[model samples]
Target: MNFEIVTELSHLERVCEQARKVPAVMLDTEFVRTRTLYPRLGLIQLYDGETLSLIDPIKLDDMSPLWALLTDESVIKVLHACSEDLEVFHHYSGVMPTPMVDTQIMAAFLGHGLSTGFAALVDEYLQVSLDKGEARTDWCARPLSDKQLEYAAADVFYLWPLYHLLAERVADAGWNEAVNQECNLLVSKRGKTPDPEKAYLDIKNAWQLRPQQLAVLKKLASWRLREARRRDLALNFVVKELHLWKMARFDIRSLDKMVDEGFDRFEVERHGSRLLRMVSELDTLPEEHYPEAIVRLVDMPGYKQMVKEIKDQTNAVAEQLGVVPEFVGSKKQIHQVLKWAWVNGRNPEKMPDLLSGWRKAYVEDRVLPLLK
Candidate 1:
């Protein structure tokens, strides 16, 4: 499609200039981040029908000018499945694109009744199937191949045409406002920070642990989270999850031997002794002195029954509405509902905020009736 690859800051400026002139730009990004908390912005592909610009951030110094064009209220940015990219751009540039359109979201709102994958959407609308075999290829690799360039170009190149179709469909179906609302929510950056106090709940074995065990688990989890942020490396790389959980149960006296057996060599090489000291300190603490916060939910009355009923009712409502059950209320919300009952008791009024918007209509009109 005659895509111009822009690897330097100078080329980025030209691309930004063209973007300022275009009414809207179709965009996509390719990144590598398996080793870090942040996705490495390797490639930024944009097309405005007349021009296709491939921006390589690896060689560019600052992308703030491009960020300005994106966040500029006058120009619109179009994307498909843009949630992750929104987060990445916001993290790097401190600004998120506004007045954006997400083709995938638009498709669903237009009563396509499914979140269509980009390739599937392209095939359905444009009658062309994108080659995604290169999707997982390490974008950080040097010397971009022609095949890779074509594949990358296809991402945004077809997107311009695809968005044209989706935008028309959304307008015809009178779903433009709904689609825009969804896009605005996606572009916001408020919910990215993980709350440390609630972090332990994400651990798989959280329910199995006693209060004392949970205290240690919480401490370990918070420590890992803080360390991952501090080092800018992936959490799993800091300390193997198995070793972290096991540390709650096992003392650190045998940590050296475990390290020798290839247990968290990264942690061992970097902060192994400090971790050992932390574990040793935890081991010496009295069980009664630890936070007794892990409440045994199974023993609570009506907990299991309420959970079963909530799930059944949520699925039934989703079926009736022809939407995914998760769109109604997630399983975690059901668990929280049960927890709420355990504490302040059930007030159907509070359930709406606890669930997704799709559930408000159902919970208010249907599911709450079943609860009573």
Candidate 2:
């Protein structure tokens, strides 16, 4: 029940050295980053049942030991819903935890699916209600209160036991092999930066736009992405989705027209004339210069049939497993699996890293067998 709070690098190193001797550790991170490019680690909690250590990354200048623990091939790193947490570790320490056991993934093996939030998992499995009132507390603030420390401690305190329970459940259900295979990949792969050329696909009007409009959309989207990364601002803060969709056509030749059309509401209004000029330049470029194939993916007639199959199969799979369908997989992933299947003439598992955990499960259980 006692947890040690470490605020200095020397203390953190000593704690990590001791932790490295252990077989496994339960880990959780509390960070503040809504306004920044990278999350600021406010608190990091690691527990090994008998001992708990809470690290203050703010006071600690060196975390190389903790990073070493993450990269240690022999020790298993345990977490729940580790995507953002993985990103945080990679950003700050330049290491992704290897040989991880994500309870979230194991929960899906028990049919809880991916939508099970952390508090909900604790409540359901551990029979404890969590105080999420401090969920949005600013982690970057100095002099973290006792309540904040308690909240942070709660995250990892139960993780050790939770992983034990889920590991057994997954093994009993004969899913450990599949799940471990995935965890290995998560541990080994370095996260890749998104390609700028494909960034426009995230735009709201990407699928609906014509080839010419898509070319313009790509240019503007690239500009927005670069600006957001350069200024370390949220994408919406630079330019809203509707504004980008409206400008995708780039038919408005004048800055005044854009202002009259509500583009002026953007905080980047001062850059209006300059942005208009950029769009105007894109307007002059040939549509052929853009990857017309990407826009064509959404319009292919085969996609409609794949959409229907994905919906029916996903729901049926969820029903068979006694879980909600959306948690099983998303419509977009379903489409991607089918598209990949068509080209590869093999299992959907052969698809690029685009397939999420849900897709992998669906492909292994349902789609692959049906393909035969």
Which stretches of model 1 miss by more than 4 angstroms?
110-115, 189-191, 196-198, 251-262, 280-292, 295-363
- TM-score (all chains, Cα) for each model: 0.82, 0.85
Q: After superposition, how far is residue 11 of candidate 2 from its true place, in Å?
A: 0.9
Which pairs of residues have clashing backbones in candidate 2? none
Provide backbone clash counts, one per model.
Answer: 0, 0
Report the Cα lDDT for candidate 2: 0.75
Q: What is each predicted model's overall lDDT from 0 to 1?
A: 0.75, 0.75
The residue-by-residue lDDT of candidate 2 on 280-366, one tens digit each, is 787567656865734344576666665676667778877876656765556655655666666556564566332445346554555
Model 1 residue 149 CA deviation in Å: 1.2
lDDT of 1 by residue, 1-372 (tens): 799988778788888887888789988989888989778877889887788988888877888779888877888999888878887787788777777888887776654544568998899999998899998888878878999989999999999989998888778866676577667756653325787766667776666677777777777787888888888888888877766666665534565766755676667777777766665667667777776666666777676777787788877876765556664556767766666555647755554333434345556555556456
The stretch of ten residues in a row with the least summed lDDT in candidate 1 is 350-359
State, as a TM-score between 0 and 1, how close model 1 is to the true structure.
0.82
